[model samples]
Target chain A: MNHVIEIDGLTKDYGEGRGVFDVNLTVEPGEIFGLVGINGSGKTTTIRHLMGYLRPQKGTCSIEGRNCWKHAAELKKHIGHVPGEISFPDVRTGMDFFNLQARYLGIRDKTRVNSLIDRFNLDASAPLKRMSKGMKQKTAIVAGFMADAPILLLDEGTTGLDPLMQKVFTELVQEEKAQGRTMFMSSHMFDELEATCDRVAFLKEGRIIDVVDMSLLGGNEPVKEYKVEFTSDEDYQTFLAQSFLVKRHRDDYKQVSVLLSDRDLNALFASLSGLDVRYITQVPRTLEDQFKEKYQESEGTNHAY
Target chain B: MPINSALLRQTTRENVTLWGVLTAVQCLLVGVIGMTAPIAAAGIAYYNMLPGIFMGVYAITVGNKLISSQVDRGTLAYVLSNPVKRSTVIVTQVVFFAGSLLAMCTLSAVAHSLGAYFSTFGANSAEIQTIFKLNLGLFTLALSFAGIVFAASCLFNLSKYTIAVGGGIVCAFLLFPIMAMFGSKFAFLSNLTVVSLYKVGSIMASGTGWAWDLVILAAIGLVAFAAGGVAFVRRDLPL
Candidate 1:
């Protein structure tokens, strides 16, 4: 299938180990694809290349089959972007800046822009210079989405946003996806990606080490992990001997983490009935946990959590 | 259109204040000098030096603001992310810069002419022509200075580098002419700088010979502007 966005063997070496290296990814139509990495992990560099702000040192990237570098301006007609940095052009207020952008994008309709402004609950009257980081980010978000372009390339689009606002952003992303828009967003925030992305790529030391399809990850899995603590060591030891898969156990705390499929959930509760059970809580297998495991494994270090 | 009118409007809004203040000061200086002093005296005293300094300062600051400072601040990313092309942005800015400079010189010329026309001595057409020639020469020299700084502005992502190189070139040009004033040995220094091409002496002497120098100054400006525009369009922007 032809990708909405395709990056193949894309490399941009800023020297001293500071650039993206031979990265490859493709976002299908209506998919929300994410690039996740720590700071300086080449996320922004990759986005900039897609934005055509940098020429690839090796290989090429394209949007809708057209080269990003050669057809950047033309491609912009169908794409919206939120730069990593939030500095705005010389404009007094957020509304003015949006108006200017609207003019450039040639969007005569203010309905989408006004709706986005309202949805974000942004006070467009505030002076941009005085706006806080979160406010500026919201302004950038509104600008990026207001164009209603079919594709968006966002570099850390949720930085400085409050948790509630981040939810709003994710909901916005989901809504856009429902409308059949494709997004290629980069963020270090795992939860944001986990909530919305269909697939997430882990970028480490300038290279894409892994791209995990979200459907295959924890939340969608049939198996679940539960951490149970027993009042007595005998109960903990006995629980460990059960048919349940023991993911890990703590001797001092008398706790055992059990992995059980949904069908075995009744069996788990039935067996735990006789034990001097203190507390039993489900341990969610989050994307952070998965990323942490992969991240540590790739670094050849133990960042035990 | 190669020029985005919306971007042009934004660029003009950002720059008009500075252009206004500088243009006002230049016009006032030319007017006051022409009103009180003779053409030959004003040519040597005012036109030969002061206007060049003002232009140099204005050119250095605005040239950076036009392209390099935007790139440095990462604001250019916002501009570029839109449907607007790099050539569109560069060309629109150049049009604004060239237009503003042209307007500055034109206004100053009018002020000088009016000042001489209303002076107690009531200047002749010959002397009035000299005022226009002097300001015209000043305009071309400043435009060339604008071009150099603009090229520097386009070539670098940092304003410090743009100011250092572009501002440095204008300063050197302005300095060379003053250094030439010290003595005969330094007289050769005037030939080394573009400011000398303004030729206040030649214009004050007569209008005929100074036209070629003005053409050279204009040509230098065109070339610099072209190089800067091409560099901005072709080079990779970190933004």
Candidate 2:
């Protein structure tokens, strides 16, 4: 796989303030990689380092095999970055900002810019200072997309958008992905990432705790959850004896829920073959739960891989 | 060169109008003063000193903030992120500030010279030329002060107290000649005085050349400028 971003032992400190410590991660080309963390968990600081806004005190951060600080201008040309905070002086209108950014990026696509403005439902003539937060976010989104760079680095890109706007943003990301764009989005919202990102890196206390491939959750053999209603105590005891069961919750002896891993689900079903299976529901784990598990594991030890 | 031209055009359009209007207003006020009192034409030279002093003080106080505001506003990162070199940004700032100062000083000098030319009774050609030469020297002296202070501002991120102290130090330097006249025995302090350059100008006005002093002062200004450029390229922007 062609890696678009390669961060190796990237460490930065802010003189007694909070910053990243020995972060390492690789984002592949055309992949949507999510960086999930709470506020002040070094998400912004890491993004800043990637954007070449801050130099790492130790280690290296490279984009497409180019050192970020040494080759910032060249790297920036291929990376469209949206800062966590969207702030422009009062004089710049949405259109004016687009024009300025386009000129700077050396993009001559008037059609692309117009399409982005229309799709985002942004008032091109509205001054940024006078616009609402949602409108400003839309404007920033338009600018980021209009650059048409191979990589998109979004820092809290969905903060002020409404639900419909967020849906539009997801659609836009899909379109970018279709065009083979690599997107690295840092967000606090797991659902957004769940719907869009292929992989996620869970960050906690200035370190990456876990890196998960969402596609691996259910491989050829799918993990399934079953809420079995036992007729008597004998049935419950028989199900508990099976080794494929990963977790079981039994409030009373009548009903019990079992969570099985993908590998063990087939064996578990074989044990229940020819028996009256009350109900077999294949429920996938929500991104929130997976993220929580990763976060929990990361709190005790560093498990970035 | 094209990119530099485009950047320069943008900066000029933004800064020139304000600088021009203020300069015109100062010139008109001085012209009115010189025209109203013909016998006090010698005093008009002293009156011209007011605006020159104001310009020096304003440049020292405002130049650093103007350059540093780009960093504060987060625009410096955006600009640096472009394909332009760090040297280009520093050079652009120096050119912008220098051009604005030169334009304003030229306008002020012309207005003051014309006022002095028309108002003086029995004034010879030599006297008029001498006064013009003095004003030119004054402009250079004032620009040097601005350049030095601008360099200092770029060198250190001054706090409120530091700014106050800088202002106090500048005021003392400008007022050193007056202080020296009042029985201060520290004769070596004259070398540190900008007003002493005006005396040099006065002496040189009578067909003499203080080329060595001018060369030394020009070297000081150039050094300050070079230092400002070095500081700009090395200082990390606020994250």
Candidate 3:
């Protein structure tokens, strides 16, 4: 029940309703809480407040009961962060920056450092200015995680990383989670959040619309969806007459997408036994769909991804 | 101290090439040029004003880049991510500025002393002492100018605004004296700037009050430098 991080009525109004508005959330110790949202959705703003880089106008963000702004220098001792935009110091090479960070953080052991380099396939000897975006991202990842702080704040954590690197980054996050590091991550990738987070919050236009437990989307009582296409119009019409929730129906294609509990699957298949069915496939239910369902009507005009 | 060392090393390494070029140019202008001309006039004209102005310009460049531009470029975010306080970062920047000023001024003074030594064929210790004092005045004066720019760098986030305001004030300080040459009415405007205090002919004529000049320069430099640290601590960075 102890919250490692907590935000209470935090608000910063940047005029024209642009900034975060009355956001409240708590992150318990060892919880990998995810903030999933599209661009310009106040993810960075919220994280900035937690980092004590931005002051809140209305409320407070606290780490272990200490005010973030008042005790920023103290709080930073236990936190590691990766910003959305990465700009390194004016050092000559990646190695130079790494050395500088190590000195600044007072970290001496190079064992974890070398392992991160090997994992990311980073050539730290190259000049920082000459490094590519992916290399820079990898370098930032290593620097942020190298300190091994108990808390991590990552804003768009996997941005600019290639798919292969992203997979590596996700695996690294899982490893960090296993070690009980409390993390607050903002990412546009739903699958990443789905794979790693215990709970994910959906934000839109600087407001938190919902916070969902990922475990609820799985577990004992599961809701499964299946799309059934009938060979003719009569079978499609007959299937729709049965006691099944039709999520979507395309009359032209003679297809009916139905949502039902696992208990209803026997009745559904038995009813379809005599039907002229062309194809039946289970539709994957994902965090993306759950997010869309929450705010689809209100945000219909906004391009999500 | 670690923050100071890391930032200082990075800044010094980044600027070594430029510093080397400036030092060579100072050697040529202050060292080689003073060897041929009449010592007093050359001291007032080339040694006092030229190198002093160059030092001011260099201060402006370094002060602008050290903090404000770094914030604009997003590097300050990384610095702030560390456990170091924002006030400590400003202190580290101030240390870097002072170190750079010391390095640049020491090399220039040595170069000018070599010129004065050769101009007198290695005989007049008095003239070399005078050059040292002159360069000391120039270094302090440049520090005052750089201090103003440092405060501006801390106050503003954008480099263009910092440069415009900082560069504008320093340029006015340098140019007002030049404008005074065309008319007597404008001479009062030149007196208001720090560069006006470096009038070598009058300082040489007075012979002993360089202490007051040094005090004024140091006071202005220290006050501005202190103000920069305070401003950086209180102000919100765009990071």
Highest DockQ, which number? 1
lDDT of 1: 0.90
Over the stretch B23-92, how does candidate 3's per-residue lDDT look in tens digits? Answer: 6787777777667665577776675567766876787888888888998898988778888788778877
Candidate 1 C-alpha lDDT tens digits along A117-202: 99989999999999999999999999999898999999999999999999999999999999999999999888899889999999
Q: Given candidate 2, what's the lDDT at residue B2?
A: 22
Listed in order, the DockQ scores are 0.75, 0.38, 0.56
Candidate 1 similarity to native, TM-score: 0.92
Q: Give me the runs in candidate 2 sitting further than 4 Å from their true place.
A: A89-92, A217-238, A248-259, A273-278, A302-305, B1-10, B33-49, B60-62, B117-135, B152-204, B207-218
Model 2 scores a C-alpha lDDT of: 0.69
Query: Residue A181 CA error for candidate 1 (Å)?
Result: 0.9
Fnat scores for every prediction: 0.79, 0.26, 0.57
Better of 1 and 3 by lDDT: 1
For B1-239, candidate 2 gives per-residue lDDT tens digits of: 22344345445655666677668886786566545554234444463356656665666555654455445555554455455555676677667776777677677656755775677453456655554554556556656666676566555544343245444555766777556666758666766765565553334344555545555555666677778778866665553
lDDT value for model 3: 0.83
TM-score per model over all chains = 0.92, 0.85, 0.89
Which CAPRI tier for candidate 1? medium
